[model samples]
Target: MSLNRRVFLGTTAAASAAMAAPMVMADGHGKPRVVVIGGGAGGATAARYIAKDSKGEIDVTLIEPTRTYYTCFFSNLYLGGFKDMNDLGHSYGGLAASGVNVVHDWAVGVDRDAKTVSLAGGGSLGYDKLILSPGIDFVDGSVAGWDITSQNAMPHAYKAGSQTELLKAQLKAMPEGGTFAMVAPPNPYRCPPGPYERVSMVAHYLKNNNPTAKIIVADPKPKFSKMALFQEGWGDHYDGMIDWIGEEFGGGSVSVDPGAMTLTIDGEETAVDVCNVIPAMKAGHIAEIAGVTDGNWAPVNAVDMSSKADADIYVLGDASQQGDMPKSGFSANSQAKVCANAVRGALTGSKVFPAKFSNTCWSLIDTNDGVKVGATYEATDEKIAKVDGFISQTGETAEVRKATYEESEGWYAGITSDMFGAKT
Candidate 1:
């Protein structure tokens, strides 16, 4: 509802310190080495926090293919033309300054028995503890005739980066009165409210640039997160520009015909000028190889985010299964803090106290109009339960809406600052 001043201060200090220090590498030898695979929301946050809290006691090595990460949280704003890549993009310079060894490489697999991680560069990294937060991988066969190749033609844009750019470009290129269709993923995936939020943002773009263009959503589930609120917003805000087909309308068989650029529903087919398909997903390959994911996601002890598969391993972000908690960036960021504390405690043999984790996910229905839901959580031996939380009530007041927007921006700054920044 409001800015978190305490966390914001911590984040700012870490970022500032990182900017000051340029070349920091003492963890390669000595100290417990924590190899964090992935540099997205989960890994970045964990690495920065661990390196900061451990005080050079734990060497954090973050393996990622890219040095920069564009926040999927605000990418919808980019789609709406309210923001640019720079507004969403973040770098790992702070982590480097905080003593995190940020490696630009893809993690291929893991030798759990030996506690080694193999990279794409034909080398292996040994770690005393491994934090796998590689995020999700699209399931190839979930949709018929849809794979990575097909996606190039009709982008998913789900994982951010180039694919997101492709989708934005396509939207801009489409002529007036053209069609924009989005295929929503089945339940239990990243960003539950993302598709609808995307719909609103895209519709906002079309409403001004291509007013006659239509936006259709093909959903696998009959219901969705904030369904009532989204429908209300679409109806009152965009009028007839947006349409959604739930399970009853789509027959629960979600597939895409990439060649035709068509979506099949029940026995009918509808063509679209641009298609965005979000496929089913699972833990990243490295996590799967390490036997961290139980089925689709990695299981962890919420108290510390340590992997159930191995004591020396931890998983966070969308790759890990956090029941009752939606798979979202906020969840991942919160989990990172818990994981960082645990890593510190484990290495120092200090008593690690459980903490109440918090998360708030804001979805931009339009630039000025948005919705947010947040919860504070606590973990017990049984499971994670919400301690306190609230969603922006439907038809929120002007002040509340504005505050939510400010909070969202603050969250972005705070999260990125925390992840890349060092501990103060």
Candidate 2:
């Protein structure tokens, strides 16, 4: 059955109660329990949709440590002063109101054999289905001379929130002609266009405040998402202020000294005021503890995002190694809906539609100058294969770029509302 808001709202309460009656008799349990770890775009959306759509047939528990979640999607805009931190921050009150049990605690471990999740607060939760969407965590020692301990001096700022604030503060306090260095990550990381957009935002900040400040990027990849668009914008907007060193130019061989405030590229060390080091990433620790991850990521069935390692445990967002789709907030949110439908169907015998997914990544280069890349996908036996795609063109009119930026604004507002309820 096609699930829509109107149909869901019009369904009689007696019908929903009848749908839940079978769950009680089948398992001798009051209701099938769904435990979701992570309260970001994926997990929050899944929990909300399952609870809202199931209509008391499912017990949805959301386990997230943070009360307020700051989105990493538009954080680059925050660095560029286009948005405020408050604009990116969302609370879990809406989820709780939507019939989800919002548990503000860390998920320390998972027992697949017993179908349970152990919390850091010394409690264990039993689940009929478990959804894992724990974004990303840094791969230890991925960058030489940099670790979690050095985060204060050289912030990664990849996770958003306080780290983003810290990096912005460092930029504001830079000397007039200070140098800003960035160590970009390798392929298959969260948001392919992220680090480059960050460069643009950083340049925008420095152009107004510290015009003479220099920005340098050392990237392992030969080319990045929206490479042409970003290169054009950098040249047109912030000429001679940004330097991008790719793999061909020894950009791949890099290291940092956070204490000394130095970055080494190709055996040459340069002193800098601030360093943004985005190391290689992996699935969050909880996914590994759950034994769902392959290497750095957890592989999932493209059809339902159920973990390949275990059927009952599903993975979503940056942590899942679903093919083709980039690890993006939009991708995660899209995947969550599909996963929610499948899980709800499996438990309550609801209609499950064929999986279809789509994603768009928008980046702001300068004021009213935004660009985006996006794609649509379908599930195959092997992967989530891309069906078609689109990207913002180079040399577009000023009006077009402005419209794109405005579209992103609308999307940000709509997505936040979708994840957290409208009242939020």
Candidate 3:
């Protein structure tokens, strides 16, 4: 359903628990220790919730490599020039101030038996419970003839920091009336509406700066999240400027040559000024290293997001295949709260609430033109199934679209605050 101000306020209040210092456990050993292996939406929120709700009964340590976190959610707007680099960047100092022992380092390994996490810099942290939210890593050979080494030429701006800057620069440098091609990923990737939103942002930039430039999308999936809404927006705002070739129309047979800057869809090769290869992805490296992944993603109990393989560990964000979630930042944040509640209860005998989830994904088609699709979920035996949903329909008036855009702006502010604690 639509994410209104009331919902935003409620979500914010849930995460706004007052910070407290670490307290000793009943057995006099120490506080129940919880180590989080990633510092994005999932990991950070989990750490915050356990620390705050447990009232310092849980000692939380968040391990993230980056000092300054750049959000993947609003990154597309930066490429569209609606926002700048600083606008998308956040500091972990706020989380640190919230009593999370924020450790800046890579998590190299996980010893399930020992209940320890090895850091890239050496040494390990002991944990009674662990949260893994390492985000997505590209699947090797998912996109034909593309690998990590060739990323400079055909950048995947999925990570939202350096790659985003690279893609934006490449997009602006395209020749007048030149072609910009994107190789969209298959299903179950992070942010289902992400690739299309990127296309919209890129078009927003090109339409203003280089109106004659064309955009082409070669996708492996026949349909995508918010397909009808996105298609309708494309037709209304940029009818002739965008072309999408889904799998039924030769997208599955697509290949790319990074060196030559050429994309082949069904044996027809076209040279493009820029290529963004959004390859198929899986849970980050640490999930598999921890031996928690079933195959590609870490399977979790939908009730609490605990790893089905190991109860001591939990998986959140894009890394967990809990069912029916689109793997958006909002979804990860929602899951983190449920996870935090369960973790706190297990550690401190705190009150546990029934698990419920909600996610809203907002996309900007052009200036002040936005649409969204979202749902509320319930935990069932099979999966976390959708209870009810809503979407921004076509043929809406300009005022409604602008209001939708404003709602998204409010969400971005609310979620980031919910996620990182605060700016200062």
Choose the strongest candidate by lDDT: 2
User: Which number leads on TM-score?
Assistant: 3
Q: Candidate 1: RMSD over Cα atoms?
A: 2.7
Model 2: CA > 4 A from native: 1-28
Residue 354 lDDT in candidate 2: 99
Per-residue lDDT tens digits for candidate 3, residues 60-134, read 888999978899998999988899989988777677777788888899999999888888887788889989999
**What are the models' TM-scores?**
0.94, 0.94, 0.94
- Model 1 Cα lDDT, one tens digit per residue, 1-424: 4565446444355443333232233434677778889888788888887887777777778888886777788898889998898877777777776678878888888998877888888778888889988888988788776898887878888888888899999999998899998888887888888888999999999998999999888888999888887888898779999989888877367667899888777767888899998888888888888887888888887777788878999988888876567788888888888888888888877667776677777887765676788888998665556888877778787676667777788777777666666332
RMSD after CA superposition, every candidate: 2.7, 5.0, 3.1
How much lDDT does each candidate structure score?
0.80, 0.89, 0.88
- Candidate 1 structure, TM-score to reference: 0.94
lDDT of 1 at 308: 80
Candidate 2 achieves a global lDDT of 0.89
